[model samples]
Target: MIRIAGLGLVAVLLAACSGQTETGGTAQAVGAAGPTGTATVPGVPAATVAFEGGDQLSPKDPIVVRASGGTLQAVTVTNPQTGNAVKGALSPDKTTWTSNDRLRYGATYQAVATAVNPAGAASEQRGEVRTIKPSGVATASLFQPSSGDFGVGLVLGLKFDHDITDKATVEKSFKVTSSPAQDGGWYWVGKREVHYRPKEYWKAGSTVKLETTTFGMPIGGGVYGGQDVSATYKVHDSWIAKADGKTHQMKAFHNGQLVKTAPISMGKTVDTPPRGPTPTFNGTHTVLSKVDHTIMDSCSYGVCEGDPGYYKAPENWDVRISNDGEYLHENLKTVGVQGSDNVSNGCLNMNTENAKWFFDNFNAGDVVEVTNSGGPQLSINNGHGDWAISWSAWQAGSALRG
Candidate 1:
């Protein structure tokens, strides 16, 4: 008689008439269509196997195992060549199993699963597959300001080394937080640079942190990210200056209260030839850098240093505001015109005493907003000139929608 199995063959027979002993003795053949395990319930998973299709696979597809008329008893997917089991979880009912880890590219994988019915009969499946080979991998570099007190006009920015076709994916991997909360938005200035600035100036003494997990991320063009990025900074003070070229005056404020007002000479608007339109930038600017002493030369502006109109003079108290050569420093030769008129290349000019006083009083990251000049407005890349971009226009450039 056949044993308890659905296959068209018997597992063993008692042979009650042929056998002479009281114990069972006869033997029978096992069915070829039975499960891989010895329990021999039915055919291999009966068409419900998750990987029934032939397995030349994508890198991201999950390896799965399922049962038709039974509960899953065992399932394990592994990279045979590496001997590493792919991590996965089984369903609560124990009827299904699937891989949860991201598989490595250009690797071969194998899976085996066994299921048993309520009647104790069992079935199983086994298969192997190979994943696609990659053509390229992407990478990028990150930049963040070192730990220091920044000007009130603080802007957090990032730079990538590659052309990212999937911008939203790249942006989603970053996180930004601040103490004393801030209302800020990130703007994608160009294809690769994203800048985040507050709607108003950052609150004084606030701490901000920016982070990104793009490293190892699977970017487009088969490129992976370079490394993780993170940085924290402090907002120092609220020293804001409104330098009005039209009024030939500058007013400095400390903590939102007026502290000092000085008559200043801004760049001229065709008030003199050769220096025509040397009118200072007419928008918001941040103090880029400072030099205790340096030679002020016209050669930097393309004028020959020794030319009749060009002068190379060693000046003191030079605080730069733009990469295009704008400084708020004493103009000894034109000190007479400073309070009286706008003369000198696009810079905020002050008398020797006043210039030295302001320079010594201000710190890095101070704001120098040159207004009332009929000149070109400051640009996004013009030395921390993030304030030059309007808030609305800036928000429109973000990968995240308004």
Candidate 2:
């Protein structure tokens, strides 16, 4: 015999009373007794299952479940393909169940919860969600001074193919080593490019190595790529050359020792214009800056005002040997004034910084042996003075450079 509980009988009676009876048909069944003094339908298990929270999941977070008005029997969450499973028990009140496991990045997971009522019948509910990985490194490329060129001004530059998420990690991958070691640091120019220069120019005759090891860096949210690279170059010799305007000669030095001395023409006195007069004397000067192409104008030096003769010059051959407008450059035209007293506006005219091997070896601080100029030594303004300025003077400049 079927026995209906107080609440169950009320529910059945309400359903039966809602229906109308026909003339020949018996009265609709009600309560624990139907038309024949017994309930026609069997009892329905009282289980009710549901997820406490909405069916959504985060990649690396946890999920919760709940069941009510029943006895919760089991709770299981699993990754179908991977067969990874997590099992938990429901609270005694049959209200909730919770699984403890961090969801995997870039993965999908499934969960199923079950419960039974006092009658021993069961009910179930299921859910699914997907997770994604964070972005990261794709690739990198190193450029400039391609592998074998040497000297102080050889700037190490790197370009990246993808934007990096972790700049420090990517930067740490770049490594530098110098023989006859000197201290230096890397400065970032932009999103993809970075430049490395010694605190001063490289010491003459020093060896340098550059390496990039950005192989599998997580450069951003959900991306990754690239490989390792390395390049090495040698500093051949110190080719510091001194140019005297009055004497019209350039003396070269190597490794703090005297080498060949060559005749050079300097800017003429009339050439000194408004920009500022280049120094007249010669001394140890380092190559501070170099340009491949530039416009040379007499008006820039105050030679002529408007429409002064403009020369689209090949600056590649020009080497800025001093802070002022002075440069050690090739002057195929002024070969006659090289050995004798013939001044330029301020530039030191060389046959060729490259041809003289000056470009090939001289660095920012190597000594340039200048003597015999009519005036005082050229003032230090453009580049860092190595031995050109006294140690005390150099220390003073350090604060400014920083």
Cα-lDDT of candidate 1: 0.70
Q: What is the lDDT of residue 223 in candidate 2?
A: 58
Residues 272-372 of candidate 2: C-alpha lDDT, one tens digit per residue? 44434344445555566565445565555555644434334444356676555566667666666677756555566666643346655555434454555
Candidate 1 RMSD to the correct structure: 10.7
Worst 10 residues of 2 by lDDT: 12-21
Candidate 1: stretches off by over 4 Å: 1-144, 306-308
Superposition error at 345 for model 2 (Å): 7.3
lDDT (0 to 1) per candidate = 0.70, 0.54
How far out, in Å, is residue 136 in model 2?
A: 9.3
- The local lDDT score (0 to 100) that residue 267 gets in candidate 1 is 74
TM for every model, in the order presented, reads 0.66, 0.41
